[model samples]
Target: MIDFKEKVSETLSLRTGAEVTIEWRINIKGVMTGWCRLREAALILPAAEAVAGLEGRLSMITAYLSDSAKQKGVREIAFHFDLDGTTLTLGIELPLEGARIPSLTPLFRNADWHEREFMELYDIQVIGHPAPRRLFLDRSIDPAAFERLIPYSTFSNGANSKALWEKVMARSGNNRKELQ
Candidate 1:
């Protein structure tokens, strides 16, 4: 497990040429939960390492595909790496704006539906995917309308939890006392 994490960290650092954060959480069953995040693009290495490391432990990997907003025209892809004991799930969030889907079918055979789902839901262009078709979205809906439906936000959690909770309770319908 340690070797796997190290490999991923090294590869991501080398490929993206950015600082990558590596996190590992061991569940009760002693299964390792690993994740790496890069500021820019660091998809291939991280994906490859996760697959390689969790080969025996992985059961399935599910990709949740989406894209950036239409206005920006900048592609932002995010991947959720899940290593289920039986199946490893890799949830890939494609950019809604200027979306480009990299072909993972060649590397991971299970990524076909994932790519399809992205194409269907967010109208992302999945290049080189063997079968690039709609997975969940209705064929009736126009592609332009579908793009608007996708949520666009930059997510970050570097705030004080206690303070944030107090503010939340104050605004909530139920007026509960804040815990000090």
Candidate 2:
């Protein structure tokens, strides 16, 4: 079977002279499962179209927006495609500063909600989204409030609980220094 990466690359090269770079992925068990990635976020539409032409089905789309992403100066969005019984993920990197990417909802119905979610949470504008409205957050909630919420890494029990307790105590002027 032709690897999805090669197929996607070849198909896209024929359609457009753009290059699609593939990075092989290894599962948790250390087994090389598949390869993924295509082009920058700006060129994602053409790469996605090529995958679609190969009879690939869009499974889901996810956006990773965090302090780390901001630090790296990248906005990574992954488009998961089921191509010929193999799962292929196309990751596109956009600039973190004032990020804007063309919406895929015009071509794929499944892209609607995913794009909206990214727009609301990450503050990355998805231009041309059909329903350009708040998905989870209403108007009352501050747009940047999403970032203030606890990140997955800091959401654990023991250490995070102690940190939270210390923070509250410090704010209430009941910290160790004040108590002393």
Candidate 3:
């Protein structure tokens, strides 16, 4: 069977008439990881254009909120669309300082929950969201918890979080400043 990554990439590029960037990820053991950057900021226009042009079922939407992102003043939102057997991931960058992105729930019914999650967790504003409510951790939940991540070492008894971090840094090699 042909690779779904290539087919999905080609289809989206052709459909959108934009240069869609595709990155196929593979793990150390040569196992295919079902994660790819199907498109970049170049594809991001109006939310309506994306909803109408891309013919697919929205599988999931992942929002990344980080301290560095807060420093940089932008959040990264990824939309995963499943077209038949293939999956296409579209990356959308949102300003964290005062994020107010158009709601995708109007176009994709499933986006309602995901959008609400980000709004509550990351304090983002999803404009025109149908029913923006708290999915988990009500008003009483500490807002500070969302700002910074608690190191796993806090919970571990003898785990050397520093050593683990050093290993991760060694693996990554390049000291690229990731938004976190």
The prediction achieving the highest lDDT against the true structure is 2
| Residue lDDT tens for model 1, 5-76 | 676566556654556566767788878765544443326445555455545322333333333333454444
lDDT of 3 by residue, 132-155 (tens): 776754464433235556454532
Give the C-alpha lDDT of model 2.
Answer: 0.69
Q: Where is model 3 poorest over a 10-residue stretch in terms of lDDT? A: 38-47
Clashes of each: 15, 0, 0
Q: Tens-digit lDDT track for model 2 on 63-156?
A: 8766787788887778887765566777777886777888887668888888777676675778888887766655644453344584433433
Ranking by TM-score: 2, 3, 1
Q: Which is superior by TM-score, 2 or 3?
A: 2
**TM-score for predicted model 2 compared with the true structure:** 0.69
Tally clashes: model 3: 0
lDDT of each: 0.51, 0.69, 0.61
Clashing residue pairs in candidate 2, if any? none
Instruction: Provide the global lDDT of candidate 3 against the true structure.
Output: 0.61
**lDDT (Cα) of model 1:** 0.51
Off by over 4 Å in 1: 11-19, 45-77, 80-96, 144-180
